[model samples]
Target: MTSQYKSPRPLLGAALYASILDSLKAWLKSDGLAWLFAFKAALAAILAVGISMRLELPQPKTAMVTVFIVMRPQTGLVLARGFYRLCGTMVGVTVAMTLIAQFGQYSDVFIALTAIWIAICTAGAARNRNSRSYGFVLAGYTAALVGVPALQDPNAAFMIASTRVAELTLGIVCAGVVSALVFPLHASDEIETTLRAQSSSFFSYIAKTLPSRKAVEDVVAMHEHLITSLVNFESLRVVAVLETHGMRSRSQRMKRLTSELMAASTRFHILLHFRNQLRLSGDHQTLDTVNRCVGAIGRLLARSPDVLDTYASATGTAQRLDRLRLRVQRHLAYVAKQDGFTPVSSLNLATASDLINRFGTELSAYVHTYASLQDERHSRENWLEALTPKTDPFVALAAGARAAAATLTLGFFWIATAWPSGSTALAQGAAICALASTATNPFRLAIQIAGGTLIGGVVGTILVFGVYPHLDGFPLLALAIAVATMPGAFIMTRPKVAGFGIGYCVFMPALAGPDNPQSYLPEAFMNDAVALVIAMVVAAAAQALVMPATSLWFRHRITARLKAEIATAYGAPLRGLRAEFENGVRDLMAQQLMLPRHEGLPIRIPMAWLNSVLEIGTAIIDFREAAADITSRAGLSHLGPAQAAIRAVLPLFKKNTGELRSVAIDALRDSMLAARLAADDATLLPSERSRYRDLLTALNRIKHALRDPQNALGQTGQPSVAAPSSR
Candidate 1:
């Protein structure tokens, strides 16, 4: 009894140790990566400063600031950012030299010309996406860095430009090297891991959504998440291509896989739309049939956690999907012969069958492309089409005008006041405007930037006045700088505070102005710091007040663009039509989601518009395909009413008028009648029969989608027409 009782304390002690160890492991897995990234960033900043000081550059802080600006957790991002920064710097330097040479004698003219250049670069930044946007940002800011200082001393413009370029190059090189060599995190590995996770989650999503009665809002949220993941994946892929030869070789396959995923997702969405329509119509028999078929496919898509872990397993999944596709076609024929199906229900069943078959085909292709990543001898496939993002020209132009206005306003202030730190203010404001132009909510980002700069200024002042005076050597200087910056670097890893971190790390060294023989002029430091803060405040105001993207009018404009995607489906070339249409509409939706929500605008309006666009656009594409097949095999003469029906709806896509909607619905009813008559003709060849039947299905889907009371088109008064009976 004594021995048994004595062992309980030891057991409890061991259990407690185990629990603590587990907690530590969990923290390491989550926050540990961020800590590692922070350490690497600090190391890069130190190396850049050390190199710049050793080279006896005029200001080592510029180099240090550049390191923080470009250093990322992954090697590929660092390299890609550094490469673009160098390019932008070169372009900016060239432009600055030209502007200074031409207008340096006239300060007003020089300032105006610099503002124009900044405007152009800002527009480019807003127009583009991903790292390419960073290039435009740098181009806009570098001009200010070079031209503002050179305006006071034109003779030294070349020297100023050269030094800036050299410092930036040194910083870029250091960041790239450190990121690649020191505890490297390759983008390829991240991509692979992301692919596995996304694939698994997507499979689960399909399994859950297919046969269930999930709300439309839930589906929309998931769709938004998937679209975001797709965009992020593309960004990672671009950087991965720059990081390793293996990734470069596999780039086409990766692109192909993305395209396949997009296509497959679209098909699944259409399938869901049909099932939803069936359920809404209260056609329990047809809905049950569709559910059973969909549930079977979902079960097959249901994958084990490690299903995508190996190429062989993925290949097996692909084979199963291929077999399922054939089975679906046979099942479609069986469903069509069932006696209880009404005309509308039959049409719904056929469309659902077609969608499931197409989805399976696309899913199989996606799996095959994924598996091809591990195969060295995989043949080159046709290049997958790139997503054509629909950026509003007005939005881009407004961003440009805002940046230019901010720069010109600041420039005038500098000239009017003739403050010693005016040049610094102008440069800092221009950089702030240009860098924040592409942000979803530039005003919020500007506020974060201002806060970060304030903190950075305080830290820099203390370090320069209090800490640096006691420091003796470059190593200690490096140590002090690293210690000061590491927290900001760590903050950078958390997206919520990333803007603050960026502002802190970048502006801290800049405010300190650490040089070879560092000058600690408390007065000048205070002046520069105050100027920088005021400039950021002005930039923030401009972002919020000057054609703010968050405005109701801007949201309306984006909504208009989202609706216009149906026009793409109607008129765009058939080649890559589906991908282009889907990406364009989804991209606009993504942009809309990025804008801060307003009380006046219900999110449901845009969500409804998105659903309507996808439903109608997809039907139009299928209608076109079926028409093309029927036209080639038979003739377009019989399909005239269907074609007319599609044309009638195009105008309604822009502005859903009751009159236009009624006309479209009438045309659709007539077209359905004509298509049924054509299909019933015994003279029709067996080969041509299926195409005509497909045309009817597409028309039926379009008509039903338009009639749905939940979408943008439905808000219009109902059509004053009657449907033909199945009997």
Candidate 2:
């Protein structure tokens, strides 16, 4: 010991080494991923350029630019994007060639037709979601690039289109190959990690919030997070399926899992809503009983034997939930037989039991589906329906019109001015307009891209004029290009500055025009740079002034769509209806969250509308299911009043007049009375009575939700507690 203590330097050195190792590990998990992405992008760009140069392609820079555009952190994303980019390019080139052959003699006709094509593509892009949308964007911009340059020389149109397609193909292949082979990050792995994390976090959130009196703010935040995670998971699943055959085979199962998750979350929200209503009504007895049942559920989730971070763990959790489901059923049955329970409390208990049971069923299904992913022998033949996304046709049309207007205006200006780089400017403007069509804040994105293009132009000017002149050979050129493009590639990994990075990385290469024999013309470089900047500004102006998404009318349209979900719930077919309704409403909610607040719109309006939609839509689904059960067994004659009540409320959503509200309220009251009478009938079977009671609970929930002053359909805009009262 004395000899070891003789020198503390060794100990200090060991401690320092351990600290450095920890720091390195932390960095590798966070910023290191970004650094790795940047490195891969740079390598792909260099490879694209080197091959293009060797093959003597017309424009090596096109291939290089394509590399930056398609490069992503995950192999699946890169491959998916490359595939879509290829498709878009082929379609675009074909259209460009046809347009040139037909309208080349008339510049005005060609420009107008090209603008129309861009408009259609832009609309398609805006209407679609995720990677498919990128295909539409490329289709629009590719046509512009191919046709705009060939307007002056009709004979060269075929040559230009073919060469452009070839360069793009080369870039796509190179990017895909490099991304898949070198330090590859698989989307499957990402999906697994995300599923584990989201499942665990969501379980914890439900456990903590279910039995407690969490604030409204906390619930709202959780709602937002859940919606975001739902959207991201779907996007990741799309790309992951494209990456590997195994993932492709499991696509239906994955969709089923997500759908189950959505259903389970909706059940949780409904249960929470009922709980809050009871609490606000000062029905402590009912509230306590509901809380006790919910608390039991919370305990089961909190003490789950598995962490739900792996397939094995999820399997274990599914088994646990199944057992809990049975135990809860028995417990609820025992509670139902107990004395001293009021009618309202009995109804509340029955409703809570149904919701908790449904939640357990969905959660178990979700876990089983997730666990099945590990079992290749599991049956994959059954195709499960996925969430259907809804897009507003009017919004899409407005976006397309804006893009078309911008293209036509820029094209006419270019022809009138006859500037040397006017074609380049027109192409850039069309590309920007198409690309920004789907953006939440197109004007802001355009401005950011414009700023980045300005910076890219300066960097390109310096590199071409100052650095490239002194360089020789492909290796030196590659090195210089890598050095110049790495920062932008790194920036693209960040969400806040991704648009800027995209602008810089793409425009830099276009501005430099690094061909087989480098064009070092300073005037041309300056003109292209100025033209791109002006194009971006024009795109921004169009986005800001032409049917801006942030306008009051646009927000109202979104609000109207949300309100219509109740009608959808009433009319849509019951098969796979819940998933579709939930997905559509949540999608609209996501869109509403993205729009900036207007002077005429309060910040709470969207959330209020969202709560109403979830509450009323879900209740309608439950009521319909119960009605179907009753009709199939006995008859709908017993529940005629309830059906009438639902129909009455449907019209109130369109026009919230006082008269309509009063009629809806009266109908709901009569329906509840009829259900209560049916439940009390001695002639009814036990199972039949339970069904009628469940129907009554659903109607009561809808009534309370409507009367709650926090929602859009409430009688007053003021916030107040909703006291329980018998009409």
Candidate 3:
């Protein structure tokens, strides 16, 4: 039967299809989120009721809504956010209490201090464009969460604290429950898949670099894509902890495993800039041989990142890998090198090829490690995350920052103005806490805060008058809890923000809403609106000042990925020994495609540069590989003994394709190594004279442009924008 199988095309198609299915699964899980709100509401109600019953009072808690905000989307992030919240809360409360105590009740000084704290937190939140900054904001707000209500009744501090604690614990539990019961997304799978893909494409590009002489622009784009792919893992870390039971342990393990993968990817980009050092400027065959051998290693690393253990004892591994990295670096360094016209790019190409071959051999063991551990390493994180921390610092901070800042600022603002309503500031802080958590855009957050607060206030008024009057105990409470979800329903998808708004409207009124609507509705609306403005203004101001992040910072994340892919390609030969090489290629392709793909400077400038580099490199590689597949046999046909020896090892490329490709390419590598020694002498043997002359002539004709492939973290230094758009 005539075979229908093409080289790598069909296999590549299958992997692409597999990735599409995985993305679809993620999208499905992201939607259908009612359970999250249900869980939050039930917990909030339970805490409210428990505290109220224990204290034996008109209301057990005004803090239930605040508790729900304590947990965050991811565990580690929650841990961090929780830590910041704890610290910031402690600070804010101490300051509020101290001011209030020193200046007495209704002191205008307290309002000023609150405003300051709000601004500070807003500034801190602006520093990082992520949940981490939210912690700072929450810290500013935590003060009000505890201190504001105390203003209403100083003696009830213990009751307030207890109620808050209960509500917070309940809310955390709810987050876990909701996430667990729902489709339950585990980000680890996505992380691993992307990592693998980036690795492969990188190595594929690197291997073909020698023959195709692809430009730096070609591979630069891959680097941008690579950074995005890896960073997405960080994002997923936030979500992974929402699992139950065994999932927590698995998540921990995955984190460790993934961290190593990240480091390796970074190193691969380093290799791209160094690979050129191995070949003589004019030795084309030597360079091709060098690339093939080293590229095999690069491919292996990509395909078998999870299986490095097998290579623990590999021979000449580091030396060979470093040789390629150094050579590539030499080539790339020339562009930046001030010395101009020096040809140090070919300094050590031959030695590096030999090292790559040794590393390739060691990969056998690494594959063994992966095969043994792949199942356990891959599936357990999802299961382990079942019992991880429910909330992260990001959410807590967002809640705390908005809450504390608004409460204090508004509280003081009202007092200074001799405002008729004392709770107006408190009300605004509460609403801000809820709305900010869910907003993706700051302006939108402000708008939502206003809209949500107004609606929430109306909901509160209706309940306070219509429902509370008609029903007394459980029914009234249940209705109120259900109503807490009026805005909460919008939060089903953006729960943090939605919950933020819902909390204020539902909790404030439930805690202190008037029993009748005739004369009370107007006052409630006014207070809510004032509070909304205070929180929004404070946040916006702070965001504008201290360590503010522009969109450029967000864009740079993609540049970081491109660099990572470059280095990862260089390291592949030391990793996977089988079809793992192919897997690495697909992994990069998927991740490159996965970036949110928006417009901007830090992201686009580097992205355009990195993407073009990686793409061109990838295309050049594909063509050469195809050419090698068709013409390699013919090239050796003239060398009878060598040709017969190579033919006997037919299908070598297919068989030892990944890291093992170095092993098969070793035949060519051995010849190049010999040629290098001959070049060094400046007086070649008869055979060397012919081969070296031809090789050097060929290499010169092939392009020598190379640079460090963009890395995952992009560059260490955050360059300041020269103009308005650059930063």
Which stretches of model 2 miss by more than 4 angstroms? 4-6, 213-217, 379-383, 597-603, 632-634, 657-659, 680-690, 718-727
Ten contiguous residues minimizing lDDT sum, candidate 3: 383-392
Question: What would you estimate as the lDDT of candidate 1?
Answer: 0.82
Residue-level lDDT tens digits of model 1 in 515-618: 87788777888899989988998898889889987888777777777777787898888988987887788888878787788766666677778888888898
TM value for model 1 = 0.94
- Better model by TM-score, 1 or 3? 1
Better of 1 and 2 by lDDT: 1
Candidate structures ordered by lDDT, highest first: 1, 2, 3
Report, for every candidate in turn, its global Cα lDDT versus the true structure: 0.82, 0.81, 0.43
How do the predictions measure up, each by TM-score?
A: 0.94, 0.94, 0.54
Candidate scoring better on lDDT of 1 and 3:
1
Top of the candidates by lDDT: 1
How does model 3 score by TM-score?
A: 0.54
